[model samples]
Target chain A: MLDNPYHNKTLQWLAYAAVFLLIGIVPLLTDDDFLLNQLATYGVYGLLAVSISLCWGSGGILNLGQGIAFGLGAYGMAMTMQMQSQAPGTIPPFMANNALETLPIFWEPFWNTGLGIALALLVPTLFYLIFGGLMFVARVSGPFFAIMTLAILSALATVFVALQPYTNGVNGISPPTGLVIAGTKIDPYSSTAYWLVFALLLICTFTAKLLTQSRFGLVVRALKDDPERVRFLGYNVAVYETLVYALSGLMAAAAGASFAVLTQYVSPAQFEVGFSISAVIWAAIGGRGSLLWAMLGAFTVQGAQSYAGDAFLNTWILILGFSFILVVRFLPGGFAGLAELLLGRLASLRGGRREEFGQAPAKGAAK
Target chain B: MANALILGISIASIFLVAAIGLTIIYGTAGVINMAHGEFIMLGAYATYAMQTYFGLPYFLCIPCAFVIVGAIGFVIEKLLIQYLYHRPLDTLLATWGVSLVLIQGTRLTFGSDPKYIQMPGFLSSNIELGGVSLAAFRIFVILAALALIALVWFVFYKTDFGIKVRAVTQNREMAAAFGINSKQVYSFTFAFGAGLAGVAGALFGVLNIVLPTMGTGYVVQAFLIVVTGGGALMGSAIASIATGEMQSIFAMLLNDSFARFLIFILIVVFLRFRPQGLISAGGSRR
Candidate 1:
């Protein structure tokens, strides 16, 4: 039975590959720009879901501050878009409005997309590197980890709210005019933008899968199971944990950049504690060990909420919360394990009936 | 100066009541009870419903709100929290879900608008001392919170029931072997803690807008208080009042958000130095 576990895993990979190809070709089958826009949004969420899975599922890090990393990414990308859209040789609108005679020194570097993208990865990774390093080194695990991260998020939110000159103070930043990709002007609502988002999602998903299959992945899982044992094995568990955390932050930031491009706006609301909590629910519902399950869980929950409409939107949180409880209670192995269990049961039932009836001349012959 | 002091005391009183209940549960059960804020919301709404719908006098509705909200807490403990006694992480998530349900239910029923519970004629009156006027309700809140604290102290340190509760909190298995019904103690303790939160909520609603999302704001503050206070009932009360007074004074001097940020930074720094907390030395870290 264990020998064929890889067989099921291969089948699962194929199924996910098929879904990815279908989504990639969606714009080709439809002329509806609105549909493509919605799919792009889903792709952004998928990136986030995968990022969350990499950390929480594989790294045993319950980061309730995924939104903070995302906000960093969104703010980074949005700042560049804002700077690029200003009149040639003129300051951005906010600085212009604030009576600043010259462009701020900080805003100067973001004019280059390369710098902005680099910062998007660096900022969140650095934030996590410092914070996660401190906590893990201090031996803060479990609920304390959750609370400390939440405290960091609260601080970030307050900073965002207070720094009106930079963050616009709760109003958040919107992408300025058109998105410039490698000097090519692209409408945020265009199919090209959607395709770009899809490509990024593929890259993130593939990278996450690769990370999970590597030797580092084995060490991380071992740390999760027995931290003392890993320490005894002469591995620097804190460094490994921090590295995985920074990687997760980078992935989250990448997703946030895509989200900013797709939505054309970014706000404090996007990084609220609710968003972070929902990510936890997604990770839990998708099953913690499987990347495919995490993505499927995100798609299922988000798709359900979208289909349920605006009237039910407010109640979507309650639904998600209850779903977390249900998943924890009834499906401890989550949707992925549950699917495998059902399939196995059906196969066993068929074999048993076949033995009872002496195969019954093989119902439905190949010929 | 007198008015500011009075306002500070009133705010501190609210925190004291909320943080005490939170500390009790955290200290004894090692459960953070994130839904404690929701219980406060329930209490506030219960009082609002009583006064507005039942036409009860505001004074009469206070105890009634406590009973109604306390019953809700009891039911929640018996039905949901009991199953999660051995599972802290699951308990946290489940209670979070319960809090969402409560908030959404309130939004659905109350239409998301802030509801006002009119202060009684006595509480609406103000007392003047040396040209400084203080709201009578503020005085009442301070006194009531103090009385509640005194009562809790007596129960916890001066009674057999309190001893059993504390014993179970210290070690459930050992206490059970010693003929203590840990299950019963857990239910009663959770219900009692939740009841205190409810009363805090009802009383606090008078000082602020009673809204569906009001609990969300208090939840973090309560956690900060519980952590800072040392995860014990006395420590939480003292820390909460101190923090509350500090915050109010800071807010009076600086921007409210800035004051909050400073306090949070202080707490984080304090945790770095003494992670076991201010009240409970060697307590299990939640």
Candidate 2:
């Protein structure tokens, strides 16, 4: 009825499945523990990129302060893990170093692992619901929304720095390189940690895929095309937009939580505008139109940086900037578009109807 | 107390100068111009290069920086911004890309080192009046801001070109039907805005260190000014003055960074209540 709402849904899902499978088997295929850990780290980043695509791509919301969501999640995990390492009522190490007499009141509840994980997902969602909801309800969209998010990113990072007593200042909160349970320190670098990250990535990818394919997703996609038409059709556009913003926040928080567990650290840098812009760039390069490609784009960019950044630290940013321009100007479909073209050509040569695989009319959301 | 007040005005003037160009470009072209700060950065670098290599005086570097950066802005408008005017978000991202390229290009050329422009001796001296001592350069900046504001007013309100820009901005199709070339108006307005940014940069280089990344530091404030001002000359001026004074007073009472944080929070709250900013330009709210 919606004209096959999803373009090549079967093929897209298959592509996602194949990529997930490939990610899943990497650890098993390689004896290199270091490489495994690196990919695991990238797996967390990939989740952030997917969250960007989920909002900017599917939901037609460009949230440039996505790092703030990640930062909230990471800080949640870091605080919990930090408290776990310390005896009850003792000041955290960083605070103690700063000569704070006691642990801050906010840090008191984070001692519980369950509360920490809950807060990791909840804090960012709450922020997005309120912040994004206010903007959407007030009918502020387009570049204005983008700038507001950018401002939030800048402000949040500075706030993190200014609130040094709670955030450990610019030095950030780094937990010990282990998980604390009851009274024992457990190695976080173990295979269990790696698998945990991989599992979360898998869950998030599938969850997003499922969510974007639902009836609500259809309405949301329609909202992107024409808000007036959707509103006239009796949909509360603000509530739906806010819900998608919160969902994106949840995804980002998940990535942040995993990032803290993997790195044993949470820094104010996570809230930086550069970090947020990188997520946007990843989404654009991977084609904001597809969540799977967005995830791949993050991995590709991060992987390339890991390998080439050491030698061309300065040139890397220039290259990234240029590629972003080229993509936006000439290849709006991004890497996903390139893939679709190749596959479509192959299908046509095999005598398939062109209309069946034709590119859907570009949505009005971004294009 | 008086010193702090003067200091506030000086800070406001810097934001006002940088924001004016943004206000004009955005108000006329409906383009957000994300590279506004980078244009400022280019101006500073351009001044630094001229001063060091060509033995150009600081006074002369201001106009030279304008022409140099204005040309670049003109080229950007013609090559990139023209295509994305219909798509606001794409223009935002494309301009962001342009900013990144400009910043990194400057870094590669200038090697990330901070450069300073030499000040005229009289301008660098401290001026004392009524028990308040202020840097002469600060006074000059304030004067320059007032002068530029007056100049912009004269150009926008009185000139034939200003009428063309206004005509195009008000109703593009009608303006075109009336034989005005919207394309040239957009290009000139963009370049003029960019030239203003370059002048702000030349002034800023004297106040602080000039680095490729320095644009970032000023761009946020400039953007806030433009947004709060609602993308109008008067609105931007009032917004910059308000934010500048608020920041200075807060800094006097609290830490500088804390003051900034508070101002940003206030802006967020203000935007939530008034997303169209302090002044709405009527009709479409794009």
Every candidate's DockQ is 0.47, 0.71
Which segments of candidate 2 are over 4 A away from where they belong?
Answer: A1-6, A181-188, A345-367, B1-3
Candidate 2 residue lDDT tens string, A1-367: 1122136788678878898888887767876666766888888989999998988888788887899899999999898888777877688877867778977788888878888789988988999999898889988887888888888878888888888878898999998756665565544555666788888888988888898899998888887789889999999999999998899999999899888888899899899888888989988998888888999999999999989987899999999999998898888778977776666556444433445576543333232
Query: What would you estimate as the lDDT of candidate 1?
Result: 0.78
Candidate 1's C-alpha runs over 4 A off are A1-9, A96-101, A311-317, A343-367, B1-10, B125-134, B281-286
lDDT of 1 by residue, A1-367 (tens): 2122323657766876987898889888987888788878878877888888888778777777788899889888888788778766887666556567787787788878889878877888898888788778766666666777777677678878887776777888876676687789867677988899889888888777877778998888787667878999999988988888888888889888888877778888766877877777776788766776787788777778788746688777677767776776567557876876666656556665667756433432321
Model 2 clashing residue pairs (backbone): A164-A169
Best by DockQ: 2
Model 2: how far is A274 from its true place, Å? 0.7
Clashing pairs in 1: B229-B279, B230-B278, B230-B279, B230-B280
TM-score of chain B of each: 0.92, 0.96
- Compare the candidates by TM-score and give the number of the best one: 2
Angstrom error of the Cα, residue B152, model 1: value is 2.4
